[model samples]
Target: MEGHACPHEDILETMRKLLVAAALAGCALSPLTAYADAPGQSPAEKADPAAREISADQIEATVQFLADDLLQGRDTGSEYYDIAAAYVASRYRAMGLTPGVDGKWMQDITFRKASPAESTLAIVQDGKAKELELKTDFITGASFTDQLIDMSAPMVFVGQGIHSPENGIDDYAGLDVKGKVVVVVSGAPKGVPGDVAATLSRGKTKVASDMGAVGMISIRSKSAMESLPFEKLVGYIEGHAEKWVAPDGTVVVDAPNLKFSTYLSPEAAADLVDSSGHDLSALLDAYESEEEDAVRPTGFVIPGEVKVKAVSEWEEVTSANVVAVLPGSDPQLADQYVVMSAHLDHVGNHLWEAGEDEDGEPKDTIYNGALDNAAGVATMLEVARVIAENPTAPRRPILFVALTGEEKGLLGSEYMAKYWVREDGEPVGVVNFDMPVLLYDMDDVVGFGAENSTMGETLAAAGAATGIGVTPDFLPDENLFVRSDHYSFVKEGVPALFLMSGVENGGKEAFTNFLKTDYHGPGDDLSQPLNWESARKFALLNYEIVKLTANADARPMWYEGNYFGDKFDPEGPRAPAPAEAAE
Candidate 1:
């Protein structure tokens, strides 16, 4: 990564060189013309070809505006986020789509910002007391209440605190934690399949809640605690704003009061656990041993009560999903809908001061998320314009949605999927555009969670049509499938696809390198070289796939055997298909 201290002159010079290179490469590629319907054609046949076309200029324009520093990285709950939202809404209105739900394009979501008002911890060994600083020495909180807890409830250390029926392991089996504070290790028991981390994290919270624990505090592993800081830890907490679901197939409340917290400093944690007579090294060894199915808690039960008073204030801020609709020509077919979406939010400015960049210069720049999502949002807008200009609408309604708060954990999309309903109350099929363009060259398009629905085949056909092959995600073990906005829709039983360019054939090094250095840092910027032409091509291909899915007579179905497929009933009552559902 380049130093952030590049002078203004250097910035200007670099941009000039790139622009000249682009110009030399020949800037005027012919606009992809729409294919005309046959003569004496039915209303469907007379549909505009413009619906499938996207312009390079439009893509550049949207990307430029959204990635501009003035928007301050489009951070959720920041003024910059509002700017991005307003811009998207304006463009949608200009494209001639109706406002969503209440004749307004914006959907308001409420968020709570919370932190501990006061916290105190004590270590008692040999009948002696040692006090710890609240933030520096310990971190704790609960989701169940914002009120102060002033009880010295006994603490029981549970190793990994996992209870997986599928694995035939039950860590909580004979233990009762009712009204007690349970201390658990942060990660899964060692030797568990590497892929089990995600499932464990999701399920562990539920188990803790069901166990009736007053509070759950996860001690970070030694390595994790050494590397992370309170700021980043707190930042992650702020980012976990997604909607959760209960096992019974109900949408749990947005921001449910499930008190879960962690500490990032090893030194702080060592102070809390050292007083126990059991050796820390031995305990960790047992926690990490693969042979131990019955990993016992360290048995260092603390008798002193701890109290936590946390106050979270709700800030009512207005944010929007930029929406534009292309209505179908046939009244009956138009009722069904296909929606395309991308997130426009990113991890904005770093709150703490961290000194200067590499050039010995002061550094306080914002974390501009150019490629992380500005690029994706730009792609969606260009596709919208191209499809709108096309001569005819497809058989079903097409909706273009630019979502907000994705970096804050898919909050925007989750809210829409769980709460937004049509006038007659049916949900729409969502096709999400997330992290699509890659700096590396591609051999195929990778579809995350593609097997969940027949949309995978539609994506394959579109890729084939464009000479871009389709491939299932090569790194399913990473669980990339559930890491994006598409998961929210899939959880709601809405068939969706998350697309990405394939890894360069040379090796996996490129993907890892980019993520390590460029993925979320200041290094991600428009000034960096990007293959815009490939991005434009991707937009065009996506338009075609959406068109096909919308126009198909049979709605896309989830593939059997997939977890999501088995969970949702495709034949169940659907919200009234919007006029655009057919196309």
Candidate 2:
């Protein structure tokens, strides 16, 4: 929708031709076939009487409503987020699901917001000092307290400040930067496996934090500095805007205080180091050759200083989570809960940037995050509808949760998992749906974070029931396990499973291409082709699996040696065996 215009005329013509062709062939149309039935018979015939039937119309309606422009982008703490939350809650109410955990449908959370304001960094070199802007020049070192960080402290040059005992490397083994500002090269340690960019981006702050330095200044290499463009800068500003402002008109926290952290022009960093009477190139060469950790504390310390004044404004606002419950048929099992979750938030509207509509006025661009997560939330709503219509309730209570702020570090799930307690004080296992729509037919469904529990076997068997195979992640290094809400449950010692379509048999290539080109971008719209049939199959498969687990004689437990396996111990893998071995 952002780049290519939809060929509405062409699509209409194609549909008309197909209809005419079907009429000429005297083909009898069946809703079941149009929805998701196996070959040779209508879906109604093949479907188990106990299985809840979901229609394609429901999926379409849900997607349309969630992705509608009126909802904006559903960014957390924004007006759009509140609207989306209300929509989800209303859908749950219409489906006849009672409130879960509490009498209310919302679980509130607290968070701290911070931003950089009026930051100045100056280096006194040869008695001449120059100041740098906050973001354009540098960020801050990690510090939880507010203090005037004077540049008069000694400066230690640590090359690629990394200290990983697991990797047998410690960049700061002999350096003492206590009360001193440390300067380090930004990048990953040499020979680190995986994408250097991703690793460095996520690991740099932690690495600096672990070094116990007063403050850190990162020198960006020429190539790295050159890679920063206007688009990336604007995206960063837009995405982080909410994190700097609270919904209420109160500043939760001041900006962080550390030494001046910034990317200096290669020449600027070199000049500063050289002006301090140190051979910058030689120092780098020696550090590179040493292999082990190396630190060169130049006797000449440049007294760097910084002043920061950050102000945050907020407005009082409120949002909610959608909670619904399906009571179990078995009175005893009804108390145990099986939770299905998906976030209902997305990045919201973007202010106009020199753009005008056909009417010759500035136009606002709404993110309309259809695939980023709206589709997943829509699928959850449809699932709730189907399950509510089932002939008999599941053996165990099923809770449907449409969470918020998933983009904001899974905050909604974290709050619910941490605070929402059962009547008996037991935590609930979560099965979260995220990005369930697939670009093409999937022969296998990939399960992420399955190693943490025996739910992997259940998931595999569930897929097998729908004639779909189960596969482990082909790209585990991507860390899909920790990327979704399921990780929150696993962290709390609750067994959880996350599902994705398998990459085997070409699905991998398709999925990879989608991730690279479409993920999190405006291009991720509903108009993009998706295999609805496969989605339906996936929903039904999960329904069966959740139903079986809910009705099980015992609660689901973690497998031996699993990530959360220790929590269910004494009662090991066999405590609650699988309903059946996966084919």
How does each model score on lDDT? Answer: 0.63, 0.60
For each candidate, what TM-score against the reference? 0.78, 0.71
Best by TM-score: 1
TM-score of 2: 0.71
In model 2, which range of ten residues has the least summed lDDT?
Answer: 22-31
Q: Write the per-residue lDDT of candidate 1 for residues 1-583, one digit (tens) a residue.
A: 2323467887777566544533322222234453343244223223434533455555665666677555667877788898788777877776667776577777766544343445566654456666666556665542323344444555666656788776666677777777766767666656554435555655566677677776666677554545576656655554324333323534354223234454524565555556554555566656656675555553446445444444433223445666656776667765667878899888787646457669976664667777789878877777676666555667777777788778866878887777653553344466778766546555567776555567777786777666667765566546676788877787678878888777655324555666678788877777766666667666766776777787777667766544455555655433333233222
lDDT tens readout by residue for model 2, 1-583: 3322237786566446534532322222232334344354323325554343554455555666667655667877777777677667766776677876577666554443333333456665445666655444544422223333334445666666766555566667766756566677655543454232233434555565555555666666433445664334434532222221233533222223234444454555786677657766675554344355554333334444323333333233344566777887887766668888888887666654437669875554666777668767766766676677666677788888888767766767766666664573344467888886467776777777555456776775666566677876677447576678776676566778777777655788877887888677555666678666666656666666676677667777775533245532434444443344211
Error of 1 at 443 (Å): 3.7
* Cα lDDT, model 2, residue 436: 64
